[model samples]
Target: MDPAPARLAVAVKAQARALGFDACGITDASPPGSAPHFANWLAAGHHGEMAYLARNAARRVDPRKVLPGLRSVVCLAVSYPGDHDNPPPPPALRGVVARYARFTDYHDVLAARLRDLTAFLNGLGGAEARSLWYVDTGPVLERDLAQRAGLGFIGKHTNLLGRTLGNWCLLAEILTTVALAPDAPERNRCGTCARCLDACPTRAFVAPFVLDARRCISYLTIEHKGPIPLELRPALGTRIFGCDDCLAACPWNRFARAGRLMREHTRADLAAPDLIELLRLDAAAFKVRFAGTPMARAKRRGLLRNVGVALGNLGDPAALPALRQVAQDPDPLIGEHVRWAIERIEAP
Candidate 1:
């Protein structure tokens, strides 16, 4: 028979599955193994302009720093469908969006379920129990925590992937004072695989597991606010939002399957957005169109900045007129990229 705490852990995982989480595991709240590597990565100043990562460096590597009396972390995953296969190329002027962002913001989709699970844990532990949950909002090193909970292993590209879940999954976690049985930690299964590194457009991977965010297309198109580097602009290709080339190259994806949680939230429009159409989005239109999607993270100017880069990379003369219209954008950031696009299109 399972001990009382262990029985509660089993119930928690069952409740997680019932709540539409595709996978769940539990692990004691000790600092994860990735802590040392994370510190080194940050110290090397590889996180780029994302100052937030450096700000919360301590809390991210150690869960106890964020939640007192933390006993166990309930790690959960909701897998996205096989979105990275070599699908037919989008028609001309259509831009690429990262697979996961094609759905309504995953943070919102998973937050509700995480709350309910935390409530259930607190209920099972009676009035004295305390629980906290996060769906990508917290400072925790989510992938490392998930790996420690046996949910998946960190791949060579530094993204989490599972033997079954593949790389197309979003993660969530609950921290609770209630003790739960810990699952066996998952070990690296990516022995000898470096395909993900080879697939990167910007050569962001400095080595097997190290990523230089400054050169990553995803960071440039999304998190970066200033003008993208001139040399790297051509490598942006048609990816207007984030890049999935690395994730798509994983061999384990052959076993990947879509989960139910985010299926209903998928937006087909994001699969292949029209670059010219996106270039014309005014601030209000941008807000309305991407109101509930992760694309809003880039803001209107940032997205338009990316749209300009994509148009330039596509080298399609059809985009020159639209590029010229935005050449004098008041944002200066957008204007600079639009001028660059116009020049690229009109170049000999």
Candidate 2:
């Protein structure tokens, strides 16, 4: 390895950490070659109705397709540490948003940081060393790239798990023309660990390293556009936004250290939200409450739909009045879920 690229890589990584990135690494920007697997998963209907995942097959598999002259990928991870114990939902209430959605949207925070990093890299050179950034919004296999860059190993749960940051981190990438030295991929650290697989209440993980998105609470609540399947409703419990059982069960989290001031970015009202308060929100009110948070992605109807499912799972007669009110909502989908909850509440 020439001293120039090595020295530059070291400095860039240091600068990334100083800029609030939890971890950073560089790797050649080659196509992931995971297309066949992704295609098979799509073919198997594992992605459910997420047509967008199947739409950009070529661009997603090949970074070069998106940026023709890309040479290297700079993978970065930002930690979102939470100190609260995962709280049990109130007995009769509904609508429990995930903790990650409590704070400001990660897309905004990470994109700004990526822009600054891109500007710094550009200042290191000129147009000859250009870069493009992505923060979960782009067609990128961010976890694969991050793993190839040695930032972390993909745990059995399929979430990227950093040695010191665990799985409580967001991934972002920079496709650049600069030819930085690449880091070797990290070794798999999850040996004989089945905690995440066993912890999933819905059995979303069909096997190690494979997830059936349709059964995943995160996909069901947030990504799925229609009423959640009846059979899966009970399994959803009070998780109205996304599920974190897999990530929370990972042993690596025990070693996760607290980040600096950036910790404030992920910690807010999301620790354990009030179900009744969230269930009462109208579209306008939902927007105002979530504001810049990721919870806004679900929209009011989608959120209410999940909340109804949670109410059904609660089996508490006290939730009947709220469920009855939501059952009359104008949105047909929300009304259907609320009706389902009403039936459940009235059942023996």
Per-model TM against the reference: 0.97, 0.94
Model 2 agreement with the true structure over 1-348: per-residue lDDT tens digits? 567667767877888988888899999978875568777777888888888878987789888888888878899988776434436455546456665665688888888889998887766656678888999878888888888999998898888999998877888988888778899998789999999999998998878988899999999999999989888899998888998888888889998875653566754476556666777899889999888888888899888888888878878888887777777889999899889988988998
Per-candidate clash tally: 0, 0
**Global CA lDDT computed for model 1:** 0.90
- Tell me the spans in candidate 2 whose CA falls farther than 4 Å from its real position: 83-95
Task: List model 1 lDDT by residue over 279-333, tens digit each.
Answer: 8899999999999899999999999989988898888998888888889989999
lDDT of 1 at 233: 92
Q: Candidate 2: TM-score?
A: 0.94
Clashes of 1: 0
Question: Candidate 2: minimum summed lDDT over ten consecutive residues — where?
Answer: 82-91
Lowest summed lDDT across 10 adjacent residues in model 1 is found at 81-90
After TM-score superposition, what is the CA distance of residue 327 in candidate 1 from its true location, in Å? 1.0
